[model samples]
Target chain A: MLFSFLNKSVHLHGFFETDIYSDMQKPFYVKILLVATLLLGFNAFAQETDNSSAEENGSVKAEIKEFIAHHLLDSHDFTLYTIDEENNEHFGFPLPVILWDNGLKVFSSSKFDHGQAVAEVDGEHYALYHGKIVKTDAQGTINYDEEGHATNVKPLDFSITKNVVFIIVVSLLMIFMFSRMAKTYKGNMIPKGIGRALEPIILYIRDDIAIPNIGEKHYKKYMGYLLTVFFFIWIINLLGLSPLGVNVTNNIAVTFCLAMFTFFITAFTANKNYWKHIFWMPGVPVFMKIVLAPIELLGTLIKPFSLMIRLYANITAGHLILMSILGMMFIFKSWLGSSMSFVLASALSFLELLVAALQAYIFTMLSALYFGMAVEEPEDH
Target chain B: MEKLIEQFSFGLFFWQLLLLIILLVVLRKVAWKPILNAIDERESGIKNALEAAENAKKEMQNVTADSERLLQEARMERDSMIKEAREMKEKIVADAKELAQVEADNMISQAKTAIEGEKKAAVADIKNQVATLSLEIAEKVIKEKFSEEGKQLKLVEEMVSDIKLN
Candidate 1:
């Protein structure tokens, strides 16, 4: 019965592979190419299955799992993981993730099976592996081991999972850049070195962006936020160019956080003039203001939402297109077609890198604009 | 699954809020204030230097104008002194010429008077000599011609003189 099952699996794999290859030749070449590659990969595994014994198959699977676990969870490589020698274990635990509300959430290989090491402290449940706050759970519960050691159950940290390493790296880079700029200012020299490159961009944000939109009087209050947004977006966009497979800014939640910051700042800092224009709107008919009040309030909510969608959609689409093109290589199975696809994909990836920085700049610039509008004093006609 | 999403567990939110507050406070203290202060100081320094330069320029202009006025006054004083000296020299020269002419005229008049007095004296002396000679000659001739008639003529002359006196 086992033999028949293996044979059927092989037959199915071959059938799918053939279908994928045939599809590659169709008019929708790029799509066919991606499907074909995935199908062919399955077929190759099946072919290997025919020659290898069950024991060998089990060992191969074990090796693959071990490779993923060691690299992702144990902090073996520098790209995706950071090792803490003091803790003797990875810092954060990797949780099993299904889907996120805004995007796909998966456990980072950093903290695998670390749900076993959590502890409850003062009525609050915390994943306490090596004395750090690993994850916080909703309800307090202790899952005891066979030896009666208490294991803490907790909800996963979704923030770090999607692209924790990426976020960290980009944030450090931005802090470093801004810190250097501040130091240069203290030294009383026109910022030389890295400061030279960053100065014009900072000035552009202050002059062309913040002052024009926010008005001169209130622009100073929002300068800190505008600067933070500009650098944050720019740094994340730069990281997307690397081969580390980090796409933090592509997630809508990240964009939403940035937009919400702008919203809060504008709302809090708004003068009487801003609220007056929204509720009363000078020189307009009384009926018109009544009609416009709800619309204006709705617009305030929609502005941030639009900012979130625009950044998320552009970055996500760029990554998807690039990945799909790369997948085309295995699909075509023809050297000519695969080579052409690679060239096209590589060119597109380089273009996407430019787009990443551009998108970041656009998002930051737009948020500043919205802030400017919110706090803007009405013109004295 | 929907129930899980709906549950409001304050624990995670509290932690995040705490972290956000901490970040804001720390960043504001460590990074923002010092940087803004430095910029402000630099701007003020530049403004002060520019104002000082403008003040110095004004002072220099005022000094230049003052010196020019002083130089003009000095020049005018020197010109008036030169004019006064020239007029005094002309007056002294004219007085000296008039005194010399008066002395020359006085000497000429004195010499002329002395010469006229001497001529008059000399002519008077000649006339006296001529009268003496003529008287002597007439006495000699009278003595020779009529020694005997002299007593009678003397008497007749005395008689005529007496008649004439009467």
Candidate 2:
């Protein structure tokens, strides 16, 4: 029965299948609540300190929203926790904050003190205002526009922020892991140890994804990209599950860039056949061909756009739901209610784990599918 | 509007692109090609082994068929040889019987002719002996009659009388 359920779930692919296991839902909710309480206790505590208002403690919906927004944004420092509330003492290392302020400004993010202080360097003052660096007085004075928005001179930020740092760390981890996995191939063809784990996924990308979608002729050329993106996304998603909260794929910029890679590859490598079909489709009426051209052109952009949005939205939503459910545990005053909240939230986190890998798979699969479409030769009708 | 613009920052996009491209190039060389090549090698090896097994099976079948055909041919040759030997033996026996019959007939005819010749010679010898014995007996009777020459004058006269009667 369990095997059948699993098979059915696998067949359903992207369908939300947590409901199908209704029998498990009770225990599932309980366990999820337990785990979510523990996890959210850690994460929520860290975030809750950002706005420790005693009067608003009872009604933290507004604070929870603020905490969630802050959690989602990329910051310059890697602040683990605050040492003292009165002193605003933070315990974390600063990453190099690279920026273009008048001229090139390269300094450690320690100058901003985890967005808690204004930084001064070379007779110029910069304030870390709400996660954006802007030119300001030591008092951090800001002039308001007519629209009542802060008008400050902001520099072009290219800092090694928390997210960027994680990206680099993950990249290095990937490189180290794959290099070891690749090294196993020198003496024996069959992989051993880490290679054993790595080989199947590689072949799956090659045989199942790449070779089938992209023809055998072109699959080799595209295999590298497919493998790279799949592992890159998969590893990043896995990292998101950790306490470090490495939500690289959740960032629109990252997803956009990844989709852009697919888009560019498809555009550059596309044969004459792909363009011909899009521009003046064969076997269709002349009027229909003319009408279809613009839509087809828009479709080119839409494909990558959807790719970007789908990954970003899915990851972001998964995190949002988990955090919200976790926040509900604090809202429930009763032990029973709070326990139930924790359990349900915990269950959702488990689902998020699946969603993380799934989102990665979907993104890679869609990208491959698009690549396949682009390089497809016209069938003789 | 400004928040949205910050999310779509050119700097982040550019960095991300640079990082991703570097990752692709690195992984393609370090990870993908080796792993993919190994898998391909293993698959092709398995295919080659299966093909070799199929060839061996086919060869075994051919060998069996050839041997079976050869065995049948040998059996047929042995059967024909046995039949010819039996026929030659029967013909030899018949020829010997016919020759024995002819020799037996010739011996019987020669034996019969010898017996006939021996019987004729024996009869001729007995006849010669009988002729001598009768002459001897006649001479003895005439001698005894003539010895009595004194009485012959009287007998001669009687004989002359008898000859006149005859």
Candidate 3:
């Protein structure tokens, strides 16, 4: 029943999916309320099951919190769905764990037994503790430092985690879609299939975002990176919203890497005027230049820093709030309260969908803006 | 902060960076290059087609105006030609009439002079004939008068008196 509900929601591309789900001519308000109530009910159920083993005082809330945190983290296995929580049965496939401890130590994530067992590989015992692979004894004992931090030697992990899988999938999907779109160009000027839907978006990035932000002369140079980043984040964000539990952009590591790309590109491609304005303010008072130079320099670093934090925080907060709202249904336990929470959660989900695209657009737009500033030709007044 | 720091995996960052670079490179070669080129080509194609259409429209207008001007010029030329022909015909007719009047006047004057000369000659010839007849008659009368001296003397006296009275 739960799987079917999730499947129906997954197939819902937009809000106009009432006719597909039901034959009855329900009013729009009732649909909204029904969707909200359903979301609340699902959240309550998820909370109940996830917190079943840890049913201590106020355990549902704590479980929901843990669930949100777990959702935020990158995992070794891609858990598609939970079959039986008590029995620890998850209906998904394990990913390959690639680690470099002294030398290469490759193994399947299933060897860790969902982080409950220690795996002995080539006479070396290792355990999964808090989503990190650590060196442990036969008993899988994890030593802690005075600060309660793990003191166990961590292997240099390069595992194909859940997020990595999604990354690979999304990238490959992008290549397939665009290659097919490009192939259609050989036949006629008008695009078809995925190209038809994606062409306008590409043009929007080119005309509205890239060309406007990055001037036409220099826009084409940055189109590859801009287009890639835009669609990458957009698609990743959209996937994150799905029940598939692929919250990639929410990962600080991922966002940090993305921001660094923009930063490095700006730093590398910046013209002389950009540095002049940063390090030594041109067309300014000498005293003011000394004061403003440091600020300007700091601004350059802060720009990408903010870019990283903005995307990470927005996506993470979105997930947190959504999970929390859904979790609220469990605490409410009443029809009215559960329904309200569900409605709020449902509305937020729609908002999140808008945000998914909006964040991508903003990131691309800002990156182009930074590139524009970097390569801007100084005006002669 | 400690947990956050612990959660920060250099491995994840490295992998993300590496994968992103790979994605960027691969996508640039595969997706972006072609899609952008196609879009630009289509845009320029549309622009060129529109410009051609605009030029064709303007050319059509120009051709229409040119044909209209040609028609007007032909009409004007035809009108001038017809006017010139009419003027030439009228001038020729007037010149022929003037020449005919001068020739007719000359012939009439010549005929009048000839008539005057013929009348004078006829009158002179009749007077001469009359004079001859009168002389002949005079001779006969003289002869008869001589036979009859009294009648002759009376005719001579009458002639003498007629002459003295003239």
Q: What is the full ranking by DockQ, best candidate first? A: 2, 3, 1
Q: Indicate the residue-level lDDT of A28 in model 2.
A: 40
Q: lDDT value for candidate 1?
A: 0.59
Best by lDDT: 3
Order of quality (TM-score): 2, 3, 1
Which tens-of-lDDT digit does each residue in A260-329 have in candidate 2?
9999999999989989978988889999999888877777877776777678767876776677667766
What does candidate 2's lDDT look like per residue over B71-134, in tens digits? 9999999999999999999999999999999999999999999999999999999999999999
Q: Write the per-residue lDDT of candidate 1 for residues A122-210, one digit (tens) a residue.
A: 44444533212333454424456897644543343333333544555555565565666677776674665786787677768778887
Number of the top DockQ candidate: 2
The lDDT of each candidate is: 0.59, 0.77, 0.82
Candidate 1 residue runs with Cα over 4 Å from true position: A1-159, A187-189, A324-354, A379-381, B1-25, B47-166
Predicted candidate 1 versus true structure: per-residue lDDT over B9-97, tens digit per residue: 22223333343344344444554455555655766888999999999999999999999999999999999999998999999999999
TM-score of each: 0.59, 0.79, 0.79
Q: Is the docking of candidate 1 incorrect, acceptable, medium or high quality?
A: incorrect
